[model samples]
Target: MHLYTPHMLLAFLLLCLAGAAFPCSAAPADDGSVLYSTDFTNAEGWITNSKDRFYPEIETGRYHYLLEGGTGGYSAYTLPQKVNGQFTLEFDVTPEKTDDGSSFRFGIGTDKKDSQRGPLLMVELANKKDGRLFYLKTVSKENSLNLVGSSPSTGSSGATVRFEDNTTYHVKLTYYAADSRASIVVQQQGSPDVIFTASAPVSGKIEDLTNLYLTAIGDGTSGPQAEGYIDNIKLTLSPTHAAGDEKDAKNNKGADETPAPVITSAPATPTDEPTPVFTPGPTRTPFPLPPTPTPTQTPKSGLGFLVLLPALAGGAILAMRKYP
Candidate 1:
């Protein structure tokens, strides 16, 4: 049950015409300067108006923004522009659960909907009883949130910061539209210290911000929901701190003078295919060996004996023929 030879049916029709002339995927390039980036792998333009308990989950690869506590769970993503000036946002969180007055908020803003109310910038952390508070705030349509900073903490009110449950942390924000300000930075991924470092000073120009959210304060679903996982989200106008490191960031206070983010290099991916040269196959010139005929002297010495016998016979025949 195996016979197709026409050179195997033309090599199976040239592998089905080279898999229909190559094209397994190559259409994700929008470049409006990438205002949004995702690691959700496929959360498709993100948005979650809580179709039921604020469900956001993109399994094993990470993106599990749940929220329940008094039920104000949120999730958002809108940005292709708006973030007007310098920019850089990073992500890779890991909290996992929260209970006492639960909290968690991510940021980037110009909020949109929930009945209009713009302006935002976040990095909250809450867990009070005076213990796990991390901060940095600014929500305004004319002064609504306004806290503006916190990050060198440990409790006893130096400002607290107790993350440790799935422990992943990497956050990084850097909005500096000529000093309207925004600079928090957290570490914890392969730590050498730095889970805090803060700065805030907003009044306007958060580089013209847009939207990028992830909230989960808790109160209604029995008020106690705040879990986390988020992963790799990124946005960049590059330059997150590397110009003399802003005077070493005024000594970010601990973890050995925190001054971390400076990783740049991303903006090259637009190919149509041009890199395939190989050419090698034509080397074999070895064929010449057929001339050994001198091996025919096999008569050895018998040849001389035969010659003598013929001479004697010829003489006798000549005499007989003359007599006849």
Candidate 2:
């Protein structure tokens, strides 16, 4: 019996651990642009729906931008700056009690004029009939439209957070791409940090186009008195981590740890007899052989034979004694 030594066992274990740890390739760093930021307290480049009744106002050191339906419906703030790649847009939002089933859109993208040939990504917050916050995606391609998720209630683009009336909530939207794959992450204000992520394919050809705009769409279902507030619009680009590369790294590591199956060769068979060969021979005729005949002897009397045998034995004994 063979027993494994301590050193050999330790080496085997170390090899397994090393294979698991150092298997996959690391992802390359991201390269992109960082853009503009603003807190609309001074109402600089922002345009409101109505001048007197519905407009952006500064309160408690933060901007309170309002959007109403019918009387005051939809407000916008267009920026001169544009961005692409890994970027972040953060702001605060507070929905009013009278807010109907309207949606609030945030992030940077092209307007309706350049819809056909540019980049557009928007994160929309809309209230469903159940009063829960639902998220939607609208990418501009000749026309802007909503994208639905695998399930009916959930969005295919990003995660949504429920809104409380008159309650302030900080929101952030992140857009990044890796290996031609793009993704968005949305996180809501002051709670246990839960991140909602959505992904889609990125077109490699469209690299030069950029458009930045913020908008709010109104709904008149919850009476004509619906209202919402927006504040602290900031934009900046940062390094993005690749989603597919991360998964590849994990799978590669797992594959490296698994041992390959051993293969053994079958035993060879032995041959005892030589292989037979067929050769051509000349034709011949058979020959005959002569036969031999046997002879028979007759029996004598018993007394005569016994006497002759005794005399012959006595004479032989006497001759042997004389010679000795």
Off by over 4 Å in 1: 1-46, 49-66, 69-74, 78-99, 107-122, 135-172, 175-211, 215-222, 225-236, 239-324
TM-score of every model versus the real structure: 0.26, 0.50
Report, for every candidate in turn, its global Cα lDDT versus the true structure: 0.53, 0.43
In candidate 2, what are the lDDT values of residues 1-324, reduced to their tens digit? 336554455465556545444545434434433455666656666555555534556564444434333333334556454444445566776666435655555545654312223355555555545343534243433333334321113433222235457766665554444433333433356643433334443344223225444343323343434356667777666434445534443344322122111111111231354322212122211011011113233333445544555555565555556544
How many pairs of residues in model 1 come into backbone collision? 14
Q: lDDT score of model 2?
A: 0.43
Residue-wise C-alpha lDDT for candidate 1, range 277-311, written one tens digit per residue: 21212331111111112322222233555555556
TM-score of model 2 vs. true structure: 0.50
Quote model 1's TM-score: 0.26
Best lDDT among the predictions, by candidate number:
1
